[model samples]
Target: MSKKNSESDSANGVRLDKWLWAARFYKTRGLAKDAIEGGKVDYNGAKGKPSRMVELGALIGLRQGYDDKVVEVLGLNDQRRPATEAQALYQETPESIAARERKAADRKANNGALVSEHRPSKKERRQIHRFKSDVFSGESL
Candidate 1:
């Protein structure tokens, strides 16, 4: 490939929010921007702006819901791609991967203990509603 074609193929860098959206970390660029502005994303261990340029080898810390992920940028792309391709953009650190798995397992175990086989019956629902009303109204029963 010619030098010009290579340069076109790999641009200088991509915006942080754009990279997050392209990597499938967020459903849309707006969501990614919100997260960045909300302090849910850190670049190189410090808070970053949505418009910050993301280049190869940069460390990114992303908090999505209850999980935190620390990944090193491996590639840069502004356009959203398939899951497999998106995954290639960054590599999660081993410690982050292990921590996430442990947290997931703990959550699963805690939730499993409270799992019910069936939904509540009409009587149960009514009782729950009545109890909530009593509590809110400062009633004894």
Candidate 2:
């Protein structure tokens, strides 16, 4: 127990990728590294690197799916833990939470506009193809 504590406590700050994975932000360190390299992550308002050390209380901005999240590091853990425990490692800022909620609401409101009644039947598919061909044919123009 003491040895484990010593090892876990030894890290003053974990690598950006490692911390992201450990905190459940990304499923794997490689994915986290990719995100950092792809300009999807920012540390303390600057671009982040995979090898960068993640210090506590530092703000991290990362894009996850459709939501751009900003979290403040509260603790550092090198090893990945369960989702609940991982959540404890950082706190999403109130502004980030509000933004995410607003985006979600907007998406929900617009979702109905994108829904179709049903998939086109085979006959309808053929008709669509014919219509497209006729529209593009020079003879019609």
Candidate 3:
């Protein structure tokens, strides 16, 4: 009824940082605000501010760990909600999903090829020298 509409559509939207936190993009409003201030978030393809008002169907680009996500705002909420409800507030774009999956697959494929460039420690160098000397000494088994 009228009461419900008033509660849900009071402002028709909420602050970007609050929405980000409510949508579970960030665990807390502080984190969301920090991300916005740090240039880690975009609103409608432009840099976002913590107080920016979020509108439906707006594209938001944010970085989460090693993945960059582009999500379309589906709904607006200011209060943090459960994970399931939060997820319903936005939808990741298909291209973003595909990119994240491809990156994951590429990471998995290259996991075993890691190369270390650090010089051996003194202890490790000593061990290697001992092994080389033993091999050169030709000690019988």
Candidate 4:
């Protein structure tokens, strides 16, 4: 291990999920584990097991929905840090940065998601209310 790495791992190797969470890669350990299990995370550009040990210099790939990001492991942290400090634990290479940007652009171009900006039309709203009323009515045929 590099001298810098030795200093960080002094606390014992952090769990993969915990590392991701502490590094601000994922919001929670559950999400981190899910990413690992889903094959969305790769170590050294190869598939990695969720239990894989991480040290400095290891390349990590992450896929969260429409985004695919990669960062080089810099330090280990057992506890979650503030958002500002959390991002300090790793370094992202230019290649990964470009890839992620392209992936995001592609996702935006191909996926017609109106998730946040959409509102149901009046007819669509009426259909939902009618369905609920029919399901709850006392009389049955």
Using all chains and alpha carbons, the TM-scores for the candidates as numbered come to: 0.73, 0.76, 0.75, 0.65
Find the candidate with the highest lDDT and give its number: 1
Per lDDT, what order, best first? 1, 2, 3, 4
Q: Where in model 3 is the C-alpha error above 4 Å?
A: 1-10, 115-141
Better of 1 and 2 by TM-score: 2
For candidate 4, the lDDT comes to 0.80
Candidate 1 vs candidate 4: the lDDT winner is: 1
CA error at residue 117 for candidate 1, angstroms? 9.6
List model 1 lDDT by residue over 32-104, tens digit each.
Answer: 9999999999999989999898989999999998999999999988788899999999999999999999999
CA displacement after TM-score superposition, residue 8 of candidate 4 (Å): 8.8
**For model 2, what is the error of residue 10's alpha carbon versus the real structure, in angstroms, after optimal superposition?**
4.5
Candidate with best TM-score: 2
Worst 10 residues of 4 by lDDT: 109-118
What tens digits encode model 3's per-residue C-alpha lDDT throughout 21-100? 99988888999999999999999999999988899999999998889999999988887779999999999999999999
Give a tens-digit lDDT track for model 4, residues 1-141: 566875566366766787898887788889889889889998888887777777778888888777777788887776787988878889998998898888778788767674546677899899989988898784664
TM-score of 1: 0.73
